[model samples]
Target: MNPIQQFVRWEAEKPEAIFLQQPLAGVWKKWTYRQAGQEIRSMATALAERGLPPRSRVGILSKNCAHWIMADLAIWMAGHISVPLYPTFTGNTIAQILEHSETKILFVGKLDTWEDQKAGIPTGVACIGFSTYLKTPFPAWEDLVTTHPPLKEFASWTADELATLKYTSGTTGNPKGVMLNFGAFQFVMKEGLNAIDVKPGDNNRLFSYLPLSHVAERSLVEMTALYSASTIYFSESLETFGANLAEAQPTIFLAVPRIWAKFREKILEAMPQPKLDKLLKIPLVNLLVKRAIKKKLGLAKCKWVISGAAPVAPELLRWFQKLDIIIRDTYGMTENLAFSHINLNKVKIGTVGHVWPGIQWRLSEQGELQMKHPGLMMGYYKDEALTNTVLTNDGYLKTGDKGEVDREGFFTITGRIKDQFKTDKGKFVDPTPIEMQLLQNPDIDQACVVGMGIPQPIALINLSAAGKSKSKDAIRDSIAQTLEHVNPSLESYEKLEAAVIMQRDWTVENGMLTPSMKLKRNELEKANLEKYPVWYKMKTAVVWE
Candidate 1:
């Protein structure tokens, strides 16, 4: 069955169970499965009455909320494909996605910064603001629900019908819309629910903080609610994230690796060496410490804590372990609806989880990981050339990530094929694993290693808040010693020549990070080429900041 069918079933099974909990104006508001279903049906009737053609694109621009999911379901129920637009995307990017997908209806949420760009939306298309807090001159969201009765005479839907058209986070180039069918989404949701061991009617509370525009958060998260009947809470704002977490007390938690690192840093920063030592020394105090840590992270009640979107540091995993939190690292992409592999039972510290159930994986001679899954996208929307390049004749999707499966069938992602660089001797060097290791040091916030045409790999790192307070020489010494602990397993060529600490972070606005938070290596090299001489030639680690 497709996502909506499952959602419909859940509504029937648990009508009074809260499906969505939105934190608005410092208060938590709930929408039950029945209420959600009714709202979606009403909205669907309104859209159908407005004459949205079958398979017509219905785009949604917002963060994670009840309205976002409601609009998504309403579009699907109306026999239309839902296209989610990133809240942080530029007007040009949003316009490109809308035009590329030929979207005719848009549901805009509360975005104060995007008010001016609303005029850039296609002239003939319809746009509505869903949240009352939004001061836009656009029509209200309540109008959609109040205007029409539930569309009982709905058109038939098939597994082959297009369900969602998700655009990639434009990093390497222009974002392409990923066209997913009903079969693709159902397959992903099924496999994902199995891997995560989500039981229907289970008391799994999820906090919806990640942007729903991304398929990772949309499919794996929102769809799971249908399967698990979990209560999803939305965050008020970035500033209120911590407060929201404490309030949500979620049982299922998912976040990007950078956020996990920040959480670790927050705990360490709060209780430094002496205090930590004292806390650990007393057994009772240690128990209280662990509970306090969990409470602070809003993960005190978390039964399933999953981290993805980027490689998580093994050290961060151990830190979570100390607090009795089991963190499972998963690997997937937008093209596959983000359910490729999940490491849950057999936790591989340095690797992503085993290949997702019902998914087939193979590595090419060049070690590029390729996969075939029922959930894989049909093709890039209206881009046959790009589709042919990615989807092979055998139906295996080129993942671009270089990986290896161990004898036990556990998969270890080495690095991106595009990320691997050649040294002076023409030997390829993979730095992701090493970079992931360095990020675990608690003193290093972020690290990117570059060695193109150099004799050996060199690294540029951003120090953690604690490391920022240290003397340059002291920080350099600590990093060198940390490297010494991790370098024995590395090959001579893969070893670092020197490490330089960068003063600033590589952010999206600065063109150093992608929208998904992956480092833009080419951008970094271009921006820092002039400063390379001090590190590459010195043969010694130095902190530039």
Candidate 2:
């Protein structure tokens, strides 16, 4: 059972099926299955001739494109391990990962701003530019076809051999490489295809906008393309995302919570509460309104839409359901190639859903979620000490998340154990649940709860559009009312003393967030700790500069 055989078999069976749609000369260009497989085979032979040994590290640096997927399959077919880099990563981050993984070859993807990172690639590493047009001076990815002939077959890899190295953005420290074996990648992708009800040549279209380095998009979205022979459409950038969505009319959609929230906001903004409420009062009108919203979002054709990598507000989930879009919340990590369990048949609004088949999980006595699965990483690359610490003697991988299982066996992630802090009163408070509640208020765009040595947890919020545009009196009254509504559900010490509304949004480059979109709690807490008194004793809403 070789994974690369999926490509070979499909190419032989459906040689003319469109496998990729990429932007070229301001138009979408199609690549058939045979064309893609032939390119991959040629590139594999070229990589072998260049002396990339079995399991040798090969890094890919590009936005989501057909070439990116082709390069990955080629590397795996050559019996080399792939190392994917995020398009948003800084040069230093790229350099650190390259050095850590000992990457021998770098495939430079197209980048508008982060292209300068190429300078940081070590002098000895061979480099090639991945582009559809072969414009770069360096060896173009397309030129590999001419440089070497297609091999009779791609190198066969066993189930136990290494396939890829995913360097996930760390929440606590520098990123560590999560080593995924061929067996793990194959099993996870197979399970995902079954879970999503994918079928061969089913008009399954994926809008490949999310970073390919992320497991949620890579395995669940791109890997499915290998089996179903689906056509993948790559978004050029954020500016063209809307147009791309309209053009693609994708059958499957996957997005983070932030993008989903933005789509929700756009619809609600177009129709205010009074008009929407009146529309909902009528039966057929309400149905039409829901269908219209779904059609406008270009999700009317989408059979399944998934959200993961962060918690989504339950209210937002319900809002989408009203529009006839079933939003499935999933939970997984790079260590597992992102397919652990998904909420498909059972739709639990707030929970992450039950563990999928072929994976076993148990919560530690301290409440940390631990799991051992065939899909679990071999270990962190070059970090044996840290790897040993996380992998127990029995081989179950310890996920840092603190979670709870219901009697029905569904899992709910409360917070990260490292993010949990004890208050000055010695009561432990988990911020994730509190923050989720705060975000539900509809007046807070982002919220983080923190207080290391304070009497109680303090909330720092970035105001929603309603809060920002309204008068101070109206906004404060709403927040006060919201706090009153959210407080009674919490324990005595878990209740917030007061809250501060911040003016600026927390972003990745500003040191406020990790690459995976998790808040840098330590950075946030320390930066605003000095202003605690001002926010804690507040009788009225105070806005920060």
Candidate 3:
């Protein structure tokens, strides 16, 4: 099945179906399947008219929008590879990705700021605007679609032909362009569609806000739409995410662990823990409580909810499940198409669920997960050495994640192999599990455990808003009490001795977290490790930073 061709099929089969929606000037603009198809075809024709040869690389730097998806399809239709850049990327990083991919043309779509993005567009590299901010000299999206007739036929890609060059979020190192072919996308999309039933006449809706540059969001929001014909809605901004989600009542909601944590915090804020616990125990009130909570959280219509991109605490999973909300944990990297293992019906809470039926996976001697699958990408763009380092000669992709697979086939990611640190005592410690345990406390929003050449590991805890609002003594007491409970359970080597309660938030702007919301351990270490000795010298269970 050609993933791109699905748009053509759907347009003919369901011409008037609502295909896309975007918030414009406090109102939602809608597009039918046929209309979307015509615009995509028109965009493709315009690119061809600009003298772009097939197999050329085109960059798309934009946030989640109807035009972003349309541009992606148009690039594929024109037989060129699409390279997607995160909207949050700096000008330098944007230039790096575009230059590295050898992008010949770019499609500028909906974004908050175009100054930095436009500055990154290399001289002589053409850019076409899809929104108002990107204007003047270059052609505009509305003008092209209205002026140029839709191409009657688009270039058909063979299964093995390249479709996109996906750039990794790069928590460990620099981002690498993962060359994904039509076959890789088709394999996972088909396998996923087969595994999960998109019940007919369900009128499914998809809410997409996460960076589509990430493979997880791309697979769930874009590729899933191709397979299921789900109507897609784009979030306006962080301020209106709640109202947007409520309006859509999306059947499928995909998010990262950070968003899920925020939702849990919001729910707790509305109904305090004690009150929620009491209300959940009543016989008839329990059902009403669950329904009311779901509606309040805008998940009343959700049938499939997935949390991925990084490991989520098992406690978070359990908390949601108590309300009859199922959040499936999935595992995949840009090396593959992000649909390797998924927690389906029979889920083991802490694990990332069973491997796909047709895929092959195993744990290496060092407990690193390796995959041999049809969904794997071709290689890194223009970096054979880098690709060789990750891809095995025998066809296995070294996942770099240290994990364990249970006899039941559930996979649990413990931490990144590089994240393991050796203490001065010569014992290795994986901080992810400890960090996850620390995050269970409502007071702590983010936690990082580091012990490089230190006697014992130390935790750096970033406080929640509520925690920040609390008195300093109260914050210290809460963290100390949490550590008191957590310390006794772990071995001496892995236990965190002293905790530093950080006043600052760990965010993308500060470089403590990747755009995908995964913690950047190296950056965190570089920024905070020198203070460890001072904290430990205080001889207190917790120290404020």
lDDT of 2 by residue, 1-545 (tens): 45688888888999998889987656998889899888888888888988766779999988888899889988888878899988778888888999889999988876765456666778778888875633456788777787888877677788888788899877667888988888987787677677667888687888888888888888766788777778899886667778778788889888887777788777878998678879988989998998888778878798888898999889889877877788989898988777666787888888998888778788899899888888888998888998999999999888888988888777889998888888889988989999999888777778898877678888899877756778878877877887888899999999987777787788877768776677777778778888776666664443453
lDDT of 3 by residue, 340-437 (tens): 78898787898999887688878899999898988898999899998899999999999888888888878888888888899889999989889888
lDDT value for model 2: 0.82
| Clash total of candidate 2 | 0
* Candidate 2 segments whose C-alpha is farther than 4 A from its true place: 132-137, 537-545
TM-score of each: 0.94, 0.95, 0.97
Candidate 3 regions off by >4 Å? 132-137, 199-201
Candidate with best TM-score:
3
Clash pairs of candidate 1? 343-353
Candidate 2 residue-wise lDDT at 498: 73
Clashing pairs in 3: none
- Residue 535 of model 2 has an lDDT of 67
lDDT of 1 by residue, 1-545 (tens): 77777788888888998899888888888899999888899988888877766888989988777898888888888888889987777777778888888999899885646765675588777887885547556677787688779877555688877788889886577888888888887787777777667889677788887888877787657878766788888888888999999998988888988888778767878887678768877979899988988898898888778888899888788777777888999999988878788887878788887887898888899999888988889999888999999999999999899888888888889888888888887888888888977786878888998887568888899887778888877887899987787677789888877778886878765768766787878788888766665568776655464
Q: Could you give me the TM-score of model 2 versus the true structure?
A: 0.95
